[model samples]
Target: MHYLDNLLLNTDSYKASHWLQYPPRTDATFFYVESRGGVYDRTLFFGLQTILKEYLGRPVTHAHVDEARDLFAAHGEPFNEAGWRRVVDRHEGRLPLRIRAVAEGSVVPTHQALVTIESTDPDAFWVPSYIETLLLRLWYPVTVATVSWHARQTLRQFLERTSDDVEAQLPFKLHDFGARGVSSAESAAIGGLSHLVNFLGTDTVAGLLAARAYYHEPMAGFSIPAAEHSTITAWGRDREVDAYRNMLRQFARPGSIVAVVSDSYDIFKAVSEHWGQTLRDEVIESGATVVIRPDSGDPADVVHQCLQRLDEAFGHVVNGKGFKVLNHVRVIQGDGIDPTSLRAILERITSAGYATDNLAFGMGGALLQRLDRDTQKFALKCSAARVDGCWIDVYKEPVTDKGKTSKRGRMTLARNAATGHYRTVPLADEAVSLDVADAPAGYEDAMVTVWENGTLLRDWTLAQVRERAAAERL
Candidate 1:
């Protein structure tokens, strides 16, 4: 057995003893995962499909049970061997749990339940909470997707105000440069794909492959020929112009775009002297757009200076929006960019009469690695439990931290017809299950059963996810 494939060993150590901690006569438990509100007003739902397909879809084998039992026994934690064996023997090793979530890519307001889980069989009541460690990790990808989505909104706002072509240029404004900045290949695959849900520009190959493997997308993103500081500086300081020329000679073609990092030895001189003066005629006659990448200095000031130099050399035409756009040269600031810095850079350039379309952005650590579960205050808590055939509401309400309070009872995400806003409401009864198609009058249940008894019920395509994410509401 692969070391990481053991579902029993994937959770917190304390979870190994949870089966013995439930209340007496506890026959079932219901739990839900929510963003209790944090940095953003809305959370974009994502990555649950990847988790379900990659992890929960696999069954628990007898070998997995035996390995986990011995490990837990040696680690001084209790292992529920009988419970696991029963699943393997009677239920054919499949987890008897039902999971319902809002459709992937839905922008749900924080504090509403994004996912609900419960064991379908009475004997497997503890299974839901036991897997909370893995399920709640969904917060990572969801937060990354939300961040990317919000960045998209910011870019769209600036583009609409400063550029004539908003729709055509919005998709490629923010590029994902986050693969190496993340913790692992899995993080890159997950967070990278999450960013792709909102943008079409990415340098992370793993993200594109993830979309193909999990979301059934042939090619979810695009990247152009580009150069890094190493490639430029390898030619030595005296040969800097040769390095820039080599890039154009190799990759420049009609109607193509190529980026070359120009900050290795004096960014201003490189952009103003080399790209603007030395190669001025070559850049114009190449018939391809050249993107100058400045990887150092203050993001706003550096980008503004590069744009000014490029406009001086290439000349610019004022569009209908009265913003100056360079002829065949552009600038991409890939350094020191976050939500705050990004806004500042856009403000600086637009205030100088440059259109937002004259620049694009590539974010690395800020896009993928700089976030945590607390960034969005994600939590999965048991909300209801059944004992001796009687259902009781369950929750946590700490007076010291009212923000940490958990919801109670079985809940459903309902959307009002008149307001079109979503709210979490208790089910009519413990046994009631509402479907979106046949919802109660004036309210629609946004939750859909995505997985049941170890089988994937809903598989979303990348295009569908993008469309849902782009919706104004619902």
Candidate 2:
């Protein structure tokens, strides 16, 4: 017989020992997690189901726990011996926690409960005790989703101003080139799928796999054969025009898109002379859209310049919105695009009388790994705990930073009466009520039961998540 070690079992080795400690007579504890609203004003709720599955795989059996126990004991049990002992004592081989969450694709305001976790059995206190460790991994995917969703919103605003059909162009406007730039294969997977939740263009196969594995999507994203500097410069600087032509010759199938890195030597010469003059007729006759990637220089300035050069070479078409789109050519600015630069590039193009659809963007590090927990101020704290069979409201208020203050008691995510906006109301709030027939008219419970001990209650597909994300703008 052979066994595969649970490699992910050591993910939370850095947790404090006090997490393993509870009151002597404690029966159970409830921990609620939220974003608390950070650098970004709003939070797009995502990735709860995905992260839960990642941390706790299908039917964690006794063999899995035995492997984890063996692995931990061999490593000298660095973090806490007592915690491992308690896990062993309580090990039924499956996680004993119940996970309740808002729907995976639901977009709610930040500082609301994204997930609430607690023990499933009244007798076991350690069931949901690992929540602080388990819940931390969720912050990254959620932040990435929020950032990418905002990028989609930003692109939609500019596209709506410049084109009549915003939906047709939105999916292809932002491409993911961040696979190689991310920290690990898993990072690429999480960050890549997060971006694809709002768009359809991607090069990250790992992210596509994540969508298939976690969200049950048959196809999550699409990309075309594209050129890099090495592919072009390998043809030598002298044969740059030949190299540009070769990309089209190779990938110029009907209705297909081919991207060529045009800034190999001189971006201006490549656009104005090579793609513009030498290969202009071939590009137009090939029945393919030629995408030119500007790899260097100031992205906003260089992209606009590339668009203008393409417009001069390929000619221009004025859409119904009266914005000019260069025919047979488009610019993909992949060099230095974050959310800030992306907005800048679009604004420059639109203000310069060019359509936003004239160009697209490919983001790398900024798309995948360039975020911190505070990007959305995510924090998971114990809001209510049962002591002596009485539910006690737990909270922390700090004098140093009022923003660091945490919410108290059980939280009810409900719509405001007058404003009709979703807001987190504490159980103690005079205007708030829960789990009753006479609850406020506008208040609807946003949180739903997603996971029970060793069983997944709800499953979502990638297309469904995309639909929920698109609804955020509407």
- The runs of at least 3 residues in candidate 1 whose Cα sits more than 4 Å from the true structure, single-residue gaps closed, are 430-432, 435-441
Question: For every model shown, what is its TM-score relative to the native structure?
Answer: 0.98, 0.91
What tens digits encode model 2's per-residue C-alpha lDDT throughout 1-474?
134235226356544234446665567666777887776777677777677677665444445555665666676553343444444456544566777777676677776777777775555555555547656678888888888888988999998899978889999888988999878998899888888888899999998999988999979889888998899999998999989889988999779899998887899998999988889999999989999998999998999898888888999989999999888888888889999999988888898999887888998888887888878888888777667777777778899988878877766666554664776655543222355454466676666777776578888888888887788763
- Looking at candidate 1, the ten consecutive residues that score lowest on lDDT are 428-437
Which stretches in model 2 have alpha-carbon errors above 4 Å?
1-8, 11-16, 59-91, 416-420, 426-433
Please give the distance, in angstroms, between residue 10's alpha carbon in candidate 1 and its true position after superposition: 0.7
lDDT digits (tens) for residues 2-76 of candidate 1:
899999999999999999998999988999999999999899999999999889888899999999999999999
Best by lDDT: 1
Tell me the whole-model lDDT of each prediction, alpha carbons only.
0.92, 0.77
Each prediction's RMSD to truth:
1.5, 3.3
